[model samples]
Target: FALIHSRWTRRVTLLKRALSEIGIDPRRVHLEWISANEGAKFQRTVSWYVNEIKRLGPSPVAEVVDGQA
Candidate 1:
């Protein structure tokens, strides 16, 4: 479990870095360690993330694709 957690943490870090390099907000990425039984927690997390994305509006990458950047 320790090794798996360590590897996942590293991978998430890399993912955030890559997103930043591509003009995307790193906060747009979420990493959770919820177990399969945590249905309520999963639903709440997804709801929170959705609200956050709405608050942040569209991604810079999307504007670039639409030629508005």
Candidate 2:
């Protein structure tokens, strides 16, 4: 578990950095370690993330696409 977590942590760190460099908000991205057995947890996490993103209004990328940025 530790090895898996460590590798995932490194991957997420790199991903966040890359997103930031591209002008994306890193907070909009999320990484969660959910086993197949954690169906409820996975559902909850997805639901929460979706709500959070909705509350953020819209992505800056979308604004640029709509010519509002």
What lDDT would each prediction earn against the true structure? 0.91, 0.90
| Model 1 bad stretches (over 4 Å) | none
Question: What is the per-residue lDDT of model 1 for residues 1-69, given as tens digits with 9 covering 90 to 100?
Answer: 989999999999999999999778899988889899999999999999999999989888787889997
- Error (Å) of candidate 1 at residue 3 is 1.5
How do the residues 1-69 of candidate 2 rate in per-residue lDDT, one tens digit apiece? 899899999999999899899988888888888999999999999999999899877798988899997
Best lDDT goes to which candidate? 1
In angstroms, the error of model 1 at 18 is: 3.0
Error of 2 at 10 (Å): 1.2
Candidate 2 local Cα displacement, residue 17, angstroms: 2.4
Which residue pairs clash in candidate 2?
none
Q: Candidate 2: worst 10 consecutive residues by lDDT?
A: 55-64
Name the regions of candidate 2 deviating beyond 4 angstroms. 66-68
